[model samples]
Target: MEFHHLFSFYLTIITLTTISLFHSSKAVNPIILPIFKDTTKPQYYTTFLLGTPSLSVSLAIDLSSPWSWFTCNLVGFNDTWYSGVPNSSTYRVQRCTDDNSCAVYDSNYCYTCNSPNCKPKGNMCTGEIYPPSLYTGGSFYGGHLLAPLLLDIITVYKSNGPIPLGKRVYGFSFGCTGVDDLKGLSRYTKGVLSLARKDSNSFHGFITKAFKIPNKFALCLPSASKSTLNGAMYFGGGPYKLPPSKLDLSQFFVKTALVVNPIDVGETYGKRNSSIEYFVNIKSILVDDTPLKINSSLLVIDKNGLGGTKINPIYPYTTLHTNIYNALVDAFTTKAATMNITRVGQVSSFSACFSSKNMVGTKTGPKVPIISLKLDGRNEDIWRFYGFNSMIKVSNDVRCLAIVDGGLSVKASIVIGGKQMEDSLVEFDLESSKLRVMSSLLRFGTSCSQFRGA
Candidate 1:
């Protein structure tokens, strides 16, 4: 396999074994969502169109998050981003009256089955309510605090190559939340767009089966500075072509089996279910081709379901466990010294930083040491991070190593964040349990912002 180029998946995955949507096929056109990197929340978000008249809502993207919730009329609270509940014939709190699973969920809280609506499920609704999200990232929008599970009509814009065609889908499952639960989220976005695994309970899963499409998606996250206004996301079927050269980005993809982390990373992991988060088996990590001294045990999943490496785009930077972090920073600092790259004062969350005066810029990014992640491939496939993704600029005079110490209590030893993912293609095949990754695309003279972008 070539050592250069990159590919991976999020909600938008390029089809490697593409199935055409013929007139006689059961397939529909795949939905294309333009992804935006919001400086407000310092996170990525996408526009979600929902309901009868179609409310264009902003939603933050969280790959591991289970609920795709938004601020609707949980109470009388009003806003432009909130769902227009009054005139919406399809916007209603999904009642548990017909669901035996809901009744078995919390029999103590179960009541006489009756009518339900946009009314908050506190004391007003008479059926069993789905459990609220964990208090940390849970929901509460109205005076009524039950956080009713909501079923609404959602609009997915199908891709006709670079252009989009709208398709309205019913039976979309999500949570009805309020502004109070919006803490840590962008002030502009109403809710989160979860790209969790395609199990029976997730948003991605519902849409895949509902649309009769494949359970795979791809992501090409863009920086959008001097590039296109946004990035590209494809939900299903694709002949993912980029203009000018019409390069197939998926041709660069190398497949690896995705492992499941048996425990959630949340504080409430014990009370809830095991995490559906995506994890990859990283055999080892290297700096400048010389392997860093790391505990091999930390690279493997322990019996308690801790250790291993996780892929989470919710956070913007890569985080490492303390021991591995210490080893990496030391090795990187030593390698920098060999290159005569002067170190400066430490910045918050980053231990190693340098003065920009001594650095030279190149087409790829700043000239720096390469970081490599060795994955268990047939002939040893390794994902390399060059100058751009490896080093983050903190100030005009300073740039720091783009990795953070994730403390000792974390589940995954290495949590891959979004910053390192920019300008790359990623695809996840839930049906095959495989993760397709192309580490970087800059060398190809094209970035993600230029491919299928807004």
Candidate 2:
């Protein structure tokens, strides 16, 4: 298949200044990455500048994925979309007999194969690493880090911006896989910008330590309806000041402890905590102030490493386990009737959809019964989903609840997807082990677009 999407995803970094390579930075400046909302799909992406000459490669945002990976030197893919890896002089495959092979780093599950006589010395090994497949709803990722100047295009909308790190930040780590890893990927995105918490080795952990910045990052996904406006990601730490008010958006944050589920007895995510995922404690779920009648145990991780809720930015919508979903759908449908919003046949994947003609539209989309996630916190610590966050407009006549059913047998009972997160400022504070969130940025009279390129 011809994989090109026929649209220009030529990054929007406002300006690309000549970066001073090998420069060490210890100044207190958080990095701002311009996260883009894909026009062709329901996804957000950020650009990665790699190779000696520098290439602004677009990668989709994957919150739980351990390492960053992309298609390199691949065939039948867009030239600009995939890495022009072979063209880089510094590109070196990690030798199997050396620092990178499975024998060396067992935590990442790196593997190698002998090329010729099967002797370790005579064989040419590709130090390949396997990433979690479930996060992307795809097969296991067979993809490494090394090569050239993995320079970042610095974006600072404020007076004080990200200061480039010394020599160490020059070499960013990632993997290069084949086309099969392209599952759950849009044609516009080359690969994933994995914000996985794989410590020091993963991009998030590496950048935080290398830059001497705080081990925290902020994510603000722009609305898909506002395709022109870019989303934003604040790496390092924050004071994420956006325009109009230029207020430090961080001040509005309300947080809950970020938990880590233990590794599976079986094969959940082998030796996880290395391939770790971000989980939040879901105490209960409510539709318009009424809690759903579902077993709360399904929302917690079990001894078998099953159940729990995760923040999945790449997924199009928040997903619930079957029982929870059924209860939610029933509650929402009943609530919609009270508001005179009559039900329509299910629109797309949404189990509970309503007629747009009966729905009341507001600045933040149509008014719907708010879906509140009562996380493990004080009674006031309810993360409410407003109209825009709870409903999706499939057509002029139909509006659907953005949440879906992830089937009975699923890893995370509540997978918080992209749709529910739009215009919401989410801060992942690794240092504090807490997820501080500011939901529905528009409700605050500010959109992420206050910063140019979003």
Candidate 3:
């Protein structure tokens, strides 16, 4: 008994008991032992009794080899002892015979319990573990009124009708006088002018005053001597001057020597009948080369050459009437065109005269033009101008007289077969009661000149 001898004796006893128990159990059930024999040892006492005779101990102990154990533990082990290892830390395992090298097992294996978490080789893990909702596709991220000014212009253009050549004439005059001041006004003025040039149906208002050619004049009177006719004569035309008080150099101009013509007349009380006519000979300066056709409605003024050099009284009155008449005409024409009606007939001769009065009386005059119209397939159709009190009546069957006041109001009465059939104010204010007087004066064969002075 020494301690070393005792320890060896105990180990020998344990091994002998284990062998005996294994041998005894072999008769009932084969007991396989996991052990490897040293091939270098001699046969008798030198050979280690590593396993049973019929059982292959090497197979069970294969995994115990240094190389095998190292691979098993390094790759990933199922044993619970490695569960506490931190994913961030590395662990070293024993080397195996197959590859006598120690390997490190990182958190990857620890997270997956070291099973197949350790891939020997092949295939890769890609993509985020937790992706955003729209990660698969790109993130989605919304649209203003372009050309606001242009849009405004279009809106105004759509709402209104074409401008008249006469207005262009006035515009040119104004532009010329204050060429330096009216620089930017061209944009809007040009837009208005474009309509006049492009559209054929545009109309303008004109003023007329009655002048009687003397009855004593001979038929061969010379053109220069025509002024000698002492009879009262009506001369109406315009390149009406704008009142200096209300004139805005940026907004308006004047035209000189515009011409007005007599188309017809309406009866007054007993003997007076107002004259009606279209204003022709309006001189429009060429600004944009837009074409203008004859019979196009126009606004004209007498341009009587009154008022101070810098200030004109007749201009403002004429301008006010023209603006109202123009607006009214446009409204009616546009509405009629929209309705597909072809003819917007003659303006009410009476109302035209009244409107003229209002124009001279106030700055904000009537803005609607009264027109008399005869549509196809219809006779005696009277329509109130869309934006004005003016009425247009058709009378192809009989001669009709239309009269317009100096301010632009109109009155029309029909005379058929030498008998005045209908007398009416082709235009009238809502509050006016004088239309009744005009109605009574319409009699057959009534002379239009008798009522012209009204």
Highest lDDT model number? 1
lDDT of 3 at 65: 9
Off by over 4 Å in 2: 1-11, 15-27, 74-85, 98-168, 225-228, 264-269, 273-275, 450-454
lDDT, candidate 3, 5-60, per-residue tens? 23322332333232221111111221111111111210000001111111100111
Cα RMSD (Å) per model?
A: 7.8, 5.8, 51.7
lDDT of residue 356 for candidate 1? 71
Measured with C-alpha atoms, the lDDT of residue 318 in candidate 1 is: 86
Per candidate, the number of residue pairs that clash is 16, 4, 70
**All candidates: TM-score:** 0.81, 0.82, 0.14
lDDT of every predicted structure (CA atoms)? 0.63, 0.63, 0.17
- Runs of candidate 1 exceeding 4 Å displacement: 1-28, 74-87, 98-100, 103-146, 225-228, 237-239, 265-273, 451-454
Model 3 residue 86 CA deviation (Å) reads: 99
- Model 1 agreement with the true structure over 1-454: per-residue lDDT tens digits: 1111011121222321121111112235676666667654367776655677655666777776655666665322232123344446666554445335464322223223223542333321121112123321222121123344556677766655333455788877666566676667755566677687645546667778777788877777777632134576666634455544356666677678898767555322223356667889988889999998888999988877789988866677888889999998888888877777888999986888987776778766887788888887754477778888889888998999988887776667888887888877777788788888777778777676664311
Query: In candidate 2, what residue range of length 10 has the lowest lDDT sum?
Result: 15-24
